[model samples]
Target chain A: MKLRALAHSRTGDKGNTSNISVIAFDPANYERLRREVTAERVKTYFAGIVKGDVVRYELPKVSALNFVMTETLGGGVTRSLALDMHGKSLSSALLDLDIPEGEE
Target chain B: MKTIRIGSGAGYSGDRIEPAVELAEKGEIDYLVFECLAERTIALAQQAKMKNPNAGFDPLLEPRMRAVLATCKAKGIKIVTNMGAANPLAGARKTAEIAKSLGLTGLKIAAVGGDDVIEAIRETPWPLVESGGSTTDLGNRIVSANAYVGTASLVEALASGADVVITGRAADPALFMAPLIHEFGWAMDDWDKLGKGTVVGHMLECAGQVTGGYFADPGVKDVENLARLGFPIGEVSEDGTLIVTKVPGSGGKVTAQTAKEQLLYELHDPKNYFQPDVVADFSEVEIEEIGPDRVRVTGGTGHPKTATLKVSVGYVDSYIGEGQISYAGPGAVARGKLALEIVKERLALMQVKTTELRFDLIGVDALHGPRLSAASEPYEVRARVTGRTDTLAEAVRIGNEVETLYTNGPAGGGGAFKSAREIVAVQSVLLPRDKVAGTVQIVEA
Candidate 1:
């Protein structure tokens, strides 16, 4: 079967740009979210593997901070094959970290 | 160089014509897309299900849809659509029935479900409607509850040999994007490529909107045969850029302004239009209507969403009826306004509330009433208010009191009133990516 038709799903690495519209219930949570999620960590972890710029966006309306990673997915969209990669592991990646509050 | 064609019809709020198909055949364009899904439409589909468990609202009713499907089948064209409202299985069965009726038996049909997490409202604890200043808990009151499942399922169904794939409720762009992924064989974790396809899907999701349905160009009126509108198609390459246009000779103009409007349909920021793929920047974009029926769109950044769930809810008319009132006189407009205002004050005193209220002042709002030979000097004002709330007694009571407005109004125009039945509410919960537990069914024919 073609990779596109495969049931396995992998929703990842929006290049170096990630639209993380996050929020926090309180300043403590905000600090926790900020401490836990940082551009440097994302950049350091995926810096070698992914290409492009990683930027962070913070909103007052959002209790959390957002990240926008640009041009990180293997020279933009044309050469992607991540659909075949099992996305089941994301549950673990997300479970460990806090997502704070999210908007849209 | 192939393209996919699709559209929306039936129970939707716009013209349900098949202008998309007509243009594709005329221009030999590959794909067509139609997008029409609102909170209200799913309600109609639910009501349809009440009468016939198997029958409900589907978009195939638009004249062009039938014409396009028939013509495409005859000419060996592959078509994809999301006409399925509530019961995709039933919808696909009906599509097959139509194909057989047309003697297009080679047609393959498939339905994608299990995206509905509505039943999980009890198991999962999602934020409520007020979380985003909108209601989120669409309990049993829900008229429809289909997840915005991605388009890969449709691709799977198509791969199963479906000449036409129908879906219940997948994200609009997913339908268009998955086809490209299937054709290209793009791999998982390829977020950039997926984003590219997503951008293409977003471009063609609304057929005319991308074309000229809402363009601002002043010189685009000369295209002939506009009565039949043309459908849109996106030629997406591996790199996340594409050319958006429709079938030639199709009604509507494709210009930069049109692209901006559609781009902003769900865009929050000019440079930060984030989807699953590229964090697209509207500011970083350039548009050139290089030739007829073609507009090349470029410059989109990529990003991911922080929140996993958005809320959607619906309503079902408990009871429905039509009633009208007319007014006449030189002071018709002034009096009508006063009458409605008075009715509102009275209803407030009576504690009457409803889900929706709309009033249309017909004769006065018409075009050049003074220029036409038709002179209905009678200052008649028609006010129609319809809504579905928790109770009908208060609604009827309010309706009765409003009728008395004609006697006491300053304009002295007589008033008429009637009460329709109330409708029920269907509520569901929106969950983040982790909580969805249903399994999808993909049958290959």
Candidate 2:
């Protein structure tokens, strides 16, 4: 199963840092997200794209995990040569993460 | 049980006006907030103001005000916005003139300013958070440096009997929180209430974002009538409880999922979401689907705020030169690749001093690149070449190199477009809160 099946995400950027929020569609999947979507796993998941450290913050009540990726926008919106200047599509990239079957 | 209904009118500067008009006319909101400024918008507006003293606010300011002013005034709904961009005083005066022109009299408009810290920055050049270098490193290229202020001045303006509040570079959440503070008389240091109010403000600040406009994914996260997506209206109580919903009969859904997604949008750390008024903590916040299109959000906690305020510093980063041309028919992919290679070699031959460059195939790997996009032959591909250079002349050559591909190489290439412009980059810095004092000026029509 892909993370997209169990979660929906939104990405926001400032300077060169991108903050991506992955919220579970079902509250039952929150624990799975907590276990699988570690900051290290997320950093490895976006290996080539994100250059800086990845920090994950847990919001148990909201069943969401916020992953903040630094130095990811190439050079931020104003300077980035990428088409998606704000890294808005990064959420889609993150949603493509694979989760084992029966995990959901 | 006293609740204040605040509606988000516009998210960004060029956001849709009709939705805002809908929010004003039908949403029955006490305050309509328009978060019209982005990080770099004010800097660009400063440049525009330098060129024309009268033209620094949002381009749609006049039209948006005209469209919503009468109805809002008639309904006794107050307006709060950072549409003032680089010049709040001018924006307020312009808005006042518009009200007078509309034959609406006795409209009180307040412009809160003193966010601009360029002079102070010049006196004591602080190091930017992005680059540890001092502001002096950017030299005269620096355009604008405005610190994000809080709800103090805005609350004062609202309390001064002003119907509309115009501001420059105030924190986005503050635009929504000011009315809450003023209405509920929330003590400025009341961290818990401020945190809860900030949560509501953050959710509604992006307008349609939380109401299914940005949440829609066909088949997966299905959202209804996204095109006519209704903006969000937050019903906040004196004790900081909030119910997020949209106007009845309007399009879009405001589910707990949407509210939860928005709760973390642009948020770095849920434990410490920094705002001038409070260090908001959303980690303990709860969202429940109390009803259809209504989510009850509560339990947002907070700590004392930091002494320094974040300042958005804008400077001339560099010049960007870009060119795009479409290649169609049998070997479009091959031709697009060849076009890109030719532009690359041509830029080298022309001695274009590029700091960084990107060559992309729009129909293929422009977005995710080869990582996500599987290599496939498309019938048509748009070849785009972009580069950043220190000088405008060098930047122009980058696009000129690509434009040369029109006659130099590639087959069936057409619809060529080229552009070169200076890149005004923005970064954040922290300045002592006491250094940048804010003031409110009221204009009556």
Best by lDDT: 2
Q: Candidate 1, residues B1-445: lDDT per residue as tens digits?
A: 4434333222133653556546546545444444555434555676788789887647553344456667766666566666666666777676666666667656665666655555554455455442232233434455555555665577676667666666656666676776677777766456556656666776677666556553322342233344555556666666656777665655666755455445544333444554422344444454556777677776654445434543344444243222335567676766765666666676668666654444434454321122221444445665444333446665575566556766765555554767656444333345575643323343333
Predictions in order: lDDT = 0.51, 0.90
| TM-scores for chain A over all candidates | 0.52, 0.96
Binned by DockQ into CAPRI classes (incorrect, acceptable, medium, high), candidate 1 is: incorrect
**CAPRI level of candidate 2:** high
lDDT of 2 by residue, B354-380 (tens): 889999999998887777776778889
Q: Give the per-residue lDDT of model 1 (tens digit) for A1-104.
A: 11111111112222122232333423245555566567776565444433555565443322334445554432222122122112213212222342434421
TM-score of each: 0.65, 0.98
List pairs with backbone clashes in candidate 2. none
| Per-residue lDDT of candidate 2, residues A1-104 (tens digit) | 88899899999988899999999888898999999889999998888789999999888888889999999998788789998889999899889899888744
